[model samples]
Target: MKIKRAFIGLSVLCAIMLCSCSRTPGGIAPAGSPNGQASSQLPTATPASGSSDLSQSSRPDASTATSPAKPPALTQESIQIKLKQMTANEKIGQMVLAGIDGTTMNAQTKALIQDYQAGGIIFYKVNLANTRQATELINSLKDTNSRNSTPLWLSLDEEGGRVSRLPDELHKFPTNAVIGQANNEKFSFAAGSTIGLELRAYGLNMDFAPVLDINSNPNNPVIGNRSFGANAKVVSRLGVQTMNGLQSQSIVSVVKHFPGHGDTSIDSHIDLPVVQHDLNRLRSLELVPFAEAIKNKADAVMVAHILLPKIDATNPASFSKTIITGILRKELGFQGLVISDDMTMGAIATNYELGEAAVKAVLAGVDVILVGHEYEKEVKVILALRQAVKDKRISMDQLNTSVTRILTLKSKYGISDQKITEPNVAKLNAEVDKVMKLIQ
Candidate 1:
């Protein structure tokens, strides 16, 4: 009887040891072949806090488990310190991307840069003569702000289909529609890179190309071929690819007409176009491309002057706090620059005074106030923005945020290796020819 009891006790001890070896310390089965079944399919007991068996993803209560810590690359602390050192005028100036009358640096252009201390300059067809003249003209404009820490954003709408400010002497690239029709994102990227190389060669840092708008509506006036395609997925893929290509060549790619200008028949240049779609409709179709661009770290986004009644009925997107701040910045998670469409456009300029529009834009979370084709209006915009700040209408924090983004962009792509001189048109044209081969 004593021998039998000792054997029975040893058997029980072995059973306990085997059971314990199969389970984790928390009394849960190990994460594989629990009960001879796949661990993934079998529901297991919740792991206790600080349990080694639980993976970072499996821990329900862990804060750092679901999301890993992101590096502080674009920290606001350094930008905030720089913002504090800037003068009120400098802050206001950084918010303006002004347009000049002539290709050559005339007195008006001089004042816009030297006196007004404008942050950027956008060139138009009237400002272009030839490649050589364009290069010389851009160089002269750049020289005005050589002393300033942030160089002016020498930009132009070279979207390559219907919109192009580069003289005809330069090789012409295909439109977004042609690229989109190819149904290959690599082609779009090549197009952007080819155009970017030519633009950079001319000493132009910013190219307002790769229009993110979807060509959903065939009858749309201003953005037909300028858009990628009618499909949101295609637009999203091509837009991001093109933007990446432009930025790769050190060109500041400014994707334009945000919140979808594809379906609008009425051009904002003539009058304010309104979108009656609710937030759901926009998210499904229009906002898709913009979201992708934001996800891919686009350098800048230009807000449209159109109004979305469901989003913000009172103000156009460029001047709507609900759209820019609440939607674009907060919901969409776009931390880069938010540039306003030309304030002189008939959408806002015809409906509201330029000065008031500028103030409203700043308050609405616009970083750069684009006053194209009107120097007087640009001056008024600068003054009104400054006055708004002084009167506590626009917070200093808001102003700082805009200036910080502008400064950050300038710091990244502002410095060019190409000297500001007469550009080699033959070499640039040769590069453009090679880039155009993708579409051919």
Candidate 2:
């Protein structure tokens, strides 16, 4: 009777071991099995606090089970996966950067986020009242976009001096000209970093600033104080420093009016400004700062509405393939985002229809169209882009390429739809004061 009992006990122990070996840990099905979609179906559990035994924790009998390894975030493969998941409208929406109408969330602005799926919003003085109001407005916008697949680029022309957009509460720093006048790389970088910190405190991700344009034309209306100064080397060095400063604080610095807007006598905002400089002049003078910024890995470039008769006679730089694709992309080897200046501006609106201009801008290799005014015009541009895709005026390959660049940039900056907390005005101002002293 004792021998038989020992035999049965040994057999039961063997059976138990077989069952344990057959069952997969964490209830995950074996690979290629009918229920083996572990990546999507399985729930990952965390080990208990202070638990140090990873091997024991991974045991089938443990209270918590480890998760399968996930693919690295924001990889090229990962971005491509996301790109494949997006719809046509979603892709087109990522190419637009619209303007909001008020200081608070309005119905029209809400639609732009929810219905139109605009990729970004540029704030003007009218959209901001105070630091608290601006933070709340930005947070609300971010909250509303929480359901979006991608984050919005809350941006503005915070170039300081006359182009300043921050409310009365924030410390207004000197313009690019003042920083350029100082001609100190360290000061320029600190100035950019402070501006970036200020923008961050308000939850802004993009600044259309650190004007790379050289102030070659004293009589130039729009870019006089905005430019860093008339010297190419100084502009190049300081512009790049400022660009690096903003980038250091995780703010995207979009070096603007590419191919040089410094020498134009007229404002592109009011009308098409014509630059008579040829390729050689542009390379030597106008393109110097931009080229320097590009070398330092600039995130985005805002194309100007100025027309270079020598480069492309029929089209402005914003809608010329030769300028955007050939000059900026091919010749300069810029692999970053290409943003067009607001299409609703006088330069574009006065000449081409809003819809047609947007389409042409995309065809010219512009990635994001800034429609900074009018809900009707913004909607028109989006619809026009959609129709263009359908009619093949903008091919799917081309559309995907632009959207890929946009997503890659957004990912690179670690942009999120998650709302940020209200800024600490006192604390931020104290930080800005330190930077102010450096430049002063």
Candidate 3:
């Protein structure tokens, strides 16, 4: 009887050991265990809302899971940090927006990017041939600038009527005069949007456009058809709409010839034209559109070479601290970028030495000096700016402020050095056709 009882006890002990062996080591089932009985018996976690039901093998392990890091936000502090890292030459480069000679990238252009580190390039009829050629040239320029710290502003006048610089293949819209005559806000907006769209399609990011100068002077030689209209109210209303439209397409529209270029009898491209208006006169007529533009958040204002002697007795608007910093910035309260009209224009070139004028413009709060001609002149202007900074003619604080503005604008416009594919002329034209219909 004792032996039989001992045998039963041993048999029961062996059965218990066999049951334990059937389970996985940690009281969990091996995934493919027979009948999946152990797995079926295991407790299941309820899935959270909007979460997919994941199997144990597919779920990420908390210990090893990781998330992608986000890029730092662009802010004043971040910009300051970037500014701190830039060299004097790089900072100076940010202030120059130059023009090249050829239709394609050449040694001079390459040096501008690699050596001078020019901030921007404005293309003209000389630099464009056909759609494909222009696109290739622009892409090449961008490719060359890829190694540089900041992107180039591939820009053109492209104001649609007489001032357009687009390739022959692209369709041209009516002049600002025609659009202003139409006096249709919707049509004006569409026009600006269409222009911006085509410009962006060609990888050009800036348009020196929407001549805010009211065609007040019937005999104004330079701004004849360029002005929106003779009436300030009309210019103001349509100008703002056009500006908004261009901005809609992510193109920076530079409202030009600020403090008004409408009343000048002489073409500023040839000689300096004086605006005899005092502050009150400007506030009433000439400054109406500009004031309105500023109220509507103008991105940039191009100061003309036209001298307002009554306002600043000596320097042209582009070089006058009273006009740029005092009037436009302080009085009009314009905080956006201030660009100078082409320094190579006869008004400036014939009067002031290129280098000296550039320094004066910088000191006067002009953020960008547009040197739209001659490689030699561009180089001289750059060297002059460098020397000025070194000699304390242009203070480091002032330099930083201007560079900060330039970089901030570049950031705002999402400017990049990435190469663009060939533009589809047909597609762009088709869109432009739609806009033309509206204006017509």
Candidate 4:
């Protein structure tokens, strides 16, 4: 039973959503902080106290959490419509997701959520070891959202094959490469349909899927068969089918590794890789699926970690405006959420300071930052973001826009409509059958 002490309870869920340095099995505390108060703006994060699986989620003490300000009471629809009218911090909170792993929240994670008002929470493998246990853990996360009257974007990387995090009982669709080998559009649709149908059964709303990478580099260490194909045309055509199938089931799909990870020999999990290809080459091969997916109105776009000399000379795709805003946003016309791949990875981890990257990412136009793996790192990142706003490195208006999109997603998925409850075992098995039939 991995477990850790949560962040201090004094954190208001709204303000706790700030920045922190990286840590595993660590809690987020400010430098020189005593009794949960950071002496200054920059707080040194503390390591989580629990076993690896039990990262600090938020303050476990429910009594100390600050009362919500009168948020002009309105129906769920109005809450969504009124989202645009929220403060910049509120909006930014919607884009930031924290990590949660437990039968229930600990004090520190609760404090972080209640303090910072994070946008969402991501579950790791340790969080899903057993189906019944996972259901309870998810219930705590959902309860946190209900208390705050905010929509929680509870997310998981449940892609089948190598990345499946859900239990064996859940429907596991075939990997993209299997379908790519078939190169059949219907197969692509079937895979996505199966994935989407199964996810909805668990009350999950967002999926980080449909890898747009072309898998051109046979020796690719990170994303081999995870991609659809080696050829851009095949990737683009099948990607469209898969994305359509996902949306048909009402599950929001994100087509990822923008500006591409198709030809990289190195994995971003350890180090940042360079694309080295020219713009024309990128457009013809790597750009096809992304361009097609955006045109199809994909819900979100996950940026890659690699550097592209032809696209941006200064930073990697995650922080490059030339690639994200100039190319992906302006040129391709993608108006949905633009997310950076996990910031705690070696790619971004080795290059920039956590706080620095957090500020720059928002400035560069990414709508969300995925940093759930390392809790201490997440705190430092969030704290740095707050400091950046104070210093005007990141504009308050931009933060608001980011948060607005998150709220819109929450409303669109109707996450608040249903409580996250464990399905009866018999019914759950039937769900697996239903999805299999849809895909088969």
- Give the winner by lDDT: 2 or 3: 3
Give one digit per residue, the lDDT tens place, for model 3 in 60-161.
221221111111213455457557767899999989999999888899999998899899999999899887889789989887776565678888888878
Residue range 1-440, candidate 4, lDDT tens digits: 00011112212221333323222111222222223322111111111111122112211121211111111112334333345344455555666777754546777677657677677777777767666777666666665554443556767776566887676655466677876777777556656655665565565657788888999999999988888779888888888777776665556787888988989988999998988898889888888899888777787888888998777888899988888888888988888888888888899888888778877888899989888666688778787887777888887767766765665554344444234456444554454454344334
In order of lDDT, best first, we have 3, 2, 1, 4
Residue 50, model 4, lDDT: 17
User: Model 2: per-residue lDDT, tens digit, 230-258?
Assistant: 99999998888778877766678899888
> What's the distance in Å from true for residue 92, model 4?
2.9
TM per candidate: 0.81, 0.83, 0.83, 0.78
Shift in Å, residue 270, candidate 1: 0.7
List candidate 1 stretches off by more than 4 Å: 1-78, 416-419
RMSD of each: 20.4, 13.8, 20.2, 12.9
Colliding pairs, model 3: none
lDDT computed for candidate 3: 0.77
Candidate 1 lDDT (Cα, 0 to 1)? 0.72
Best of the candidates, lDDT: 3
Rank order (by TM-score, best first): 2, 3, 1, 4
- Local accuracy of candidate 1 as per-residue lDDT tens digits, 239-310: 887787677555778888888899898999999998888889988999998998887878789999998988
